[model samples]
Target: MVGREETTMFHRDLHPDGRPVKPEEREQLLRKVLPPTSYSDETTRSTSPKPVGRKRRILWSRFVTRIHLILFAIIQAVFSIYLRSRYLYHVIIDRIYTIMYYPHRTPEYIRRDVKALSRLPTHISVILDLHSHDRYDADSSLENLVNDVCEICAWTASAGIPVLTIYERTGILKEYLQDTHRAITQTLRSYYGQHPPSISLRAPHLQSISPPRSPNTLPADATPPRLEVTLISKDDGRATLVDLTKTFAEMAQNRKIGPEHVTGELIEQELSDLTMKEPDLLILFGPNVQLQGYPPWQLRLTEIFNVEDHQGVAYHVFLRALHCYGKAQMRFGR
Candidate 1:
């Protein structure tokens, strides 16, 4: 016999031998086959397209972040330059400051603002509306009224402004003679200590509203003017106040005294004289007080704040008034 042929099959060369193989022979043939796989080692270790796409996304995110930072830096540089220049001063100081107060209650914001104003050299004025009986005290005693005045004076002094507390009731002053006189005198002394001649307390000359004689021919009881008033809306009142101011300017220019306009002793003696002689500034607070019996004559040249009594007297209001006064041009109607 010819020597038996020993042939091994590769996995891909499993073609038919033209006869069924025995189980043992099939097993031997399978064992002779090698495992099938791709030929390139580099292709097997290569990164997938999904991972490459993620890397590109991360790089794009970094680029966007850099652009935002660059824009923020540019904006900061522009703001810094603006602040460095004097252009910001007008915005800081250009405003009319004013405040309103209920007769005796002081708000906390007012105190904070007062502390702020004390640091500055600006002069501020406060107008107070003190109710004599029902408002200021539960006991309706003169001592309470006097105490209220003292408190107000102290507040104004703290803020660096002289207090000009006005009351419609001359009776309140007369009633509180013992208490108010001492209180006011003490306030003046205390205020002058801090501000020297910059501070003073003023009470306008009281117009005598005495009862008429003759019971049979007695006049009807005169109703006191309203302590509260709603100043015409700011727009309307501003125009009217401006017009009145213009008229007063004309009068001042003429310099001739008119009989119809009787200057009250309070207006002539206390406020107008002082303001005109000093020619500094008068900031009227609580313009809604009707100014009915106030220093109406002086208000013409004065920078009237005319805030509502409900506006609550506070430090911020005064600051606003001072700011407005500072920015306002004293044309004297040139």
Candidate 2:
């Protein structure tokens, strides 16, 4: 009885008329008794938002959004058309060039085509993307990539570009290094006779693969007549830079190479020794000019070639890339 009285006294509702409150009336009586802010004043405040201004703002925002979408759609359509047209144009031109330029008969034929160029790259790097119409299956894409590498290697060899590096971002080429070497040998044999230019197939960390010298070829020497073919991947890209940095840090700590010894020339020399030297020309087998992570450090003055909407590695595109490289004047940051 005393407890009930105490509770009633604490929660008593005596708003103006001194009314005892029920559960339904408790909130109202308490609010009436308390000093309410202007926003909460039941007599003066509105719970719903104003309709006219809000609706007008919403309508304006929707209208602007619609305009942006339309503009974006139009721009996309135009760009798609441009890419398709450009790809077709290149295909037709390349087809025409093949009849006159592609070395169907012999390696000498391709060499003749190469001879016409004002200059030729000593080292050529081809960026091979592991992408194809074979979307659902990865194995199919890998085969296509291998075939692309084989074809490009043979072409570069025929063009007499002494050094070639195959850049596939995934490094699948390096993973299947032996198979790639065998395939390249077969491809070269198809182009040349049994004894093609010797290909030194090597990846970054693996042992270099070189087949036995055919009796029909040159005598055993310190450096035989061979094509230095390298396989590089994303690991050889920025990852190499990071690794190099770590190595330099360790070396500096050990007092081997000082911090000042880590100049651009020093890094370049180290990288060249570790990997291949900077390529003179970089050929992209894809339709557009996307690096797709070719080593940035190696591409300071490299001549890069791209054909819009063109897909796969074509011999004609390879030839055209060479032509483009020959014509390009490397000012080297002039």
Candidate 3:
């Protein structure tokens, strides 16, 4: 009756192609005809940038973490290599020097080396690390530290370094003073027979040792010592200062001297009398540069020397320190 009602899927009967379209089928058709969501989805774009920024931050953090790990590994590797190489270098050089100077006991040879230096220290300070008798020190005394002290004393005396201050951290050297002096005498006798440098051995706050002459040597004919040896310990470094402070306070209370008179010069003079003078050169026997609680007040203008990776004390190291001192120029805060 209406010119054959137009039969087409668009008819208002609400059936898409003879049946209602399923939700999945409708979504698929829409997606196929629609543009990319990234370009057309304006409502979701603000949250989209948020996710992108978050992702970028996560990537950046990961990158930085990786870089830090890489740098740390490189630095650690370099430091390890440097330590190994440094130790090897010192060992080889020490071996060569030992061979060249096989016998270091010749007095003339030592003197000649000293004479070549531009200057020599009058007072030399030595830091000794404690060592025990073992296969390494079979030729030395069972008391290795004592033996080292005696050897150093002999070397200093031979070098004409009159004032030698020996600092041992544990004060073990103080216990073996007698043995050390005896050994030093023998070593000096080897260097200068019959006229070994006279040594006056004393420790801080203790009386100078005046023992009976050894059975083999002459009794005192009333001659002063050429070498004045002082034994100081960690205690002497700080305790001595505390003692001086108490002494000054006691004196001030007694009206003996005013606080104004307790100046640096006065304190220095008192210290010089109590301990040895501030040394012109300090020789550390160890490889590292550790002061080991040396008297702080005395090291204000001192020159310090050490050999890298050196395990033990040796005469050549001592000699080399002296040579270095000769080549140095002291400003003293000019």
lDDT of each: 0.43, 0.80, 0.79
lDDT of 1 by residue, 1-334 (tens): 1112324223323334645456676566555453434534445557435777899999999999999999999999998887566444532432323214321323234445544432432333334444533564645644555555565555544444432434332334544344454565465445434222222323323222222233343235521111111111122223433554566568766975454463555334433323321223333444354543443443555555644332344444555665556567779889
For all predictions, the C-alpha RMSD in Å is 19.7, 7.6, 10.1
Better of 2 and 3 by lDDT: 2
Regions more than 4 Å wrong, model 2: 1-84, 214-225
Q: lDDT score of model 3?
A: 0.79
Q: Residues 198-306, candidate 2, lDDT per residue (tens digit)?
A: 8889988789998777575544542323788999988888988889999999999999988777898989998887777989988887777878777899988788887
Name the candidate that leads on lDDT: 2
Alpha carbon lDDT of residue 288, candidate 1?
54
User: Runs in model 1 with CA error above 4 Å?
Assistant: 1-126, 132-148, 158-171, 184-289, 308-311
- Per-residue lDDT, model 2, residue 242, is 86
Q: Model 1 lDDT vs. the true structure?
A: 0.43
Model 1 clash count equals: 14
Candidate 3, superposed: residue stretches over 4 Å from native: 1-64, 131-142, 193-195, 210-225
TM-score of each: 0.34, 0.73, 0.73
